[model samples]
Target: MRRGASRDKPGARVVQPPVVYVHGLGSASTVYHAHVAADPRLATRRQLFVDLPGHGISDRPSGFRYTLEDHADALAAALDAAGAVGADIAGHSMGGAVAIVLAARRPDLVSRLVLTEANLDPNPVPKAGSSGIASYNEDAFVRGGSFAAVLERVDPLWAATMRLADPLALHRTAVGLVRGTRPTMRHLLMSLPIDRTYLVGDVDNDLPGRAELAASGVRVEVVPNAGHNIMFDNPQAFINAVAGEAPRVTADAYKS
Candidate 1:
């Protein structure tokens, strides 16, 4: 159940660079190809774009629960399937959150960690009756609705990168909006023990006390002129940053 391609050189594959990509809540891995292409270093590697358990081409079973561990487990399974253990990982949005949890849980499996427009703080619990963070809670907004109705009410929650992409991608991404269970989301939100470099977008103003979260010793960079989906808006800048960090993550990996 993955829906992405892998780019690798033919013949002996000893020099393979493995990078796994986890998409945001409402999108798939197609979002990073252009960014990867912009940087030649990222261009040559086995890039895995995985869909969460119940999203995209992956199975969507009834009563399926979506937790951070579940996403991490699914990612670990994918890496095992692809023989990409100890690979560098990058995640966006919800995927970014998942990446952090995975790295924290299994540091041995992760080399470099890159998170774009992701939250590193413990999941902020919204007020019981608060309409803050838009579609994040309200079942009316998170649940059933026409596309027009959805956009009118919840489009504000979208990242800047999503705004620039084709409307069809948005439509395709909406499939993730149907959260399986309240406890699942809650469990996932509570699993963050932050420590990493998380690149964020200023226009992504939905989160509460974001500055405070940034100050928690995590290297938080606000990508200029971007939104939650920064990769789509400023692909080159994002790619360069990832390319730059790749070496830092791999510098200690001596050849066997």
Candidate 2:
């Protein structure tokens, strides 16, 4: 299992057979920290909350192309960096898309896979109002141009989204989204193959597949009372669905 920054923090315990969590677009690993922290069942599992390159404290190299494959490679590198050859994997939104790619490309590294609010459509679903733009873009464009111009464009939208997201995470996400460039995200989105078995928020504006995913042998669980940010709005529902579907092996393997 891989270790994360949480381990070195005060009162942190060693994560066994770690669980790597990939955050959604414009967000950092911290997005799932509280939700994961609240769950005792996942305590023993190490948490590798990736900040992805160019987000959070990680390096923001010039000419970085943010794509699904790039994000997956970042995850793979993170695992290798942590010496976690085998671990459980989970992601949200764009991160979810990346997680699916990672599992598909390197099945051996992933013991289990859980994706929340995964936008597998390969095309952006229209969202209304600021919450839509703020939730998705508006920040990345401005900041990604250059570090000096980054926050100049990021501040206003970041503040606005914070107000709408009663819980504060929406605001945090806005900031994270501003950190990366759109070309990278779009490139990654375009590169996605639209395949995998995972869960998506039933309330999510995008993804339109419950029947197809199930019929295709991909387990799809719908988290109710939640939108794209299921981990924040409906943690229990997300947890239950994940617990039910995300196991190291198939159901038959666990039955006996």
- Cα RMSD of all models vs. native, in order, equals 8.4, 8.7
Judge candidate 2 against the unseen true structure and give its global Cα lDDT, from 0 to 1: 0.52
Model 2 lDDT per residue over 1-256, tens place: 1111222111246544567777665456664544654476665556667766545445554444454556567677777777665566667776676676676666666766667766554435334222344453434434443322333454453333222222222333333333433444333333434433465556743445444444444555555677667777777766654444343223332111
Q: Residue 167 CA error for candidate 2 (Å)?
A: 24
lDDT of 1 by residue, 1-256 (tens): 3222333222234575476777776455654543464356666665666666544556544343355556676677677667777666778866776776677667666766667865444433342111133333334433444334544544453433333433333332332323322334323333344335556666753544444444443445557678766787767657865665522222122221
**Which residue ranges in model 1 land beyond 4 Å of their true spot?**
1-17, 32-35, 122-148, 156-195, 202-217, 245-256
Clash list (residue pairs), candidate 2: 26-176, 26-177, 66-184, 67-188, 68-188, 143-150
Which residue pairs clash in candidate 1?
Answer: 26-173, 160-228, 161-229
Number of clashes found in candidate 1: 3
Candidate 2 stretches with Cα past 4 Å from truth are: 1-16, 128-140, 143-197, 204-206, 244-256
